[model samples]
Target: MVAKNQTVVTEFLLLGFGDLHDLKFLLFAFLLIIYVMALTGNALVIVLVMIGQNLRSPMYFFLSQLSLSEFLFTSNILPGMLWLTLAGGGKISIIRCFSQFYLLAVCTVTQCLLLTIMSFDRYVAICKPLHYTIIMTFGLQLQIVTLCWSTGFILSIVLFGFLYRLEFCGPDTINHFYCDIGPVLELSCSDISSTKLVTSMLSTPLVVCPFVLITATYISIFNTILKISSSIRRQKAFSTCSSHLTVVCLYFGSLASIYIFSPKIGSNTKKNLSLIYILVTPIFNPLIYSLRNQDIRGAITKYIHLIGTWQLP
Candidate 1:
């Protein structure tokens, strides 16, 4: 049934950088460099978090999970984009498209929950320091991580599972680099009312709710800090959450913009907005987290110094 239903659309032609013959090589090189950077940087973060005992904190644990998810995300989309760009254009199979959406949703929802959980972690440490350890125990952390991934899988099944059921009777071209939901839905032949509705619901928690939680958590943290006695402790607590805050704002602000005015917006705007997270986020995340973190900075320095000493030997 799927084969017959999907016959009308064997593959989707990605309409990425269509008029950039002159810049294709340049763009390819640029994207490849970022892809490598993203992979290496995030991998380094995970390693540092794992290998460095100094980084064995609840915050770094959450960060390791984020780094892992971002690693998978970049692995999925960037390499494919690089190949397609080099090939001068490409098509993704229907099944592959659905798979992309499923995996993407899984990571995305995991990220949302992780960030929200990180916010709560900050809230606990800042507002209720005496009980922080008890509240964010190892078991509790494991449960939260499991819940994030599981929720992502369930909602993805609800969203893209139905997407797979939709017929694509015409214009099977996707105007973006990957199988983003907006472009894929635009290409579907059947009624997309339910699709739009489901998208809104799925997107709401991922976008609005976590953002609200992050915002609220920060506000309360700020309010609480004003009452703290120690300047050194207050500064330390502030620095701890700043990296996460920068990333949350960068991600949430742009995501809200795109979804808030989607479809009615043109392809170019959508593409530009997608770049904020897809390409930029992964690049910026390491820079933000590592540079801002004293321990991570020391780890990188020790790594470099160790490498230097070994090199001369």
Candidate 2:
């Protein structure tokens, strides 16, 4: 039974950080710094991977992809959030909301799939050191990366197709910094059983299944590392896995906290978790990789010296 006065919502008011009226500028400034660091750091990784001959391995290839995905992921969400923070709050058209949601979902799923592939790469490298080159050939790596990206885009379109069909008839406020599936669905007037089902189906394959695979891969990697006869080799193996493990923990931990357990938590808590998931993780990725990786650090140093020599004249 539809109300006679009910009408489709043309726009949604994003709550953003409106409650922090006194601290909006401070918040904006802080996030602005984070945004710049994230972009610069990820961009540096991409450039290093592209130009450094020593970084032409499968590991650095996947790292470059991860950095590129992080760039797009942050870009899609942060600029709009920064604007909202500067303005205190703002209305976004329904189309724009859906577009932002679609891009975010695509990048998120792509990153998950890419991370799984990288874990497999690590597994092959550590567990089968003799055959690493044969197994992780450039052709195979290309196929896997293409599959990850294509599947992510396809799944995103399917989810968006279903979501776009939902009706929003009043109460057109989104209680978050950006348009996420949960917040957007909360405002839908139409029945959401189908949407929920689709989300569950996609989420399991995109997040949970990949997470399990990554865990198993790391387990195999650790088992192999334990069998190494040399202590130095063992330390080297641990160093290689540590950075990826840190990122995995942060990425999946924040995601599960927000999407899985957030129902029992407060909105403020959820918002903060979203900030970590969306903002902080990307910024920390390059720092973790560069600081922990001798290869990356060496490449950066070499490039810096080259630039310094060029500028000396």
The candidate maximizing TM-score is 2
Can you write out model 2's per-residue Cα lDDT over 111-148, one digit (the tens) per residue?
A: 99888888998898999889999999999989988998
Clashing pairs in 2: none
Where does candidate 1 stray beyond 4 Å?
1-7, 311-313
Alpha-carbon runs more than 4 Å astray in model 2: 1-4
Best by lDDT: 2
Q: How close is candidate 1 to the true structure, as a TM-score?
A: 0.94
Range of the 10 consecutive residues with the lowest summed lDDT in candidate 1 = 1-10
The CA-based lDDT of model 2 is what? 0.90
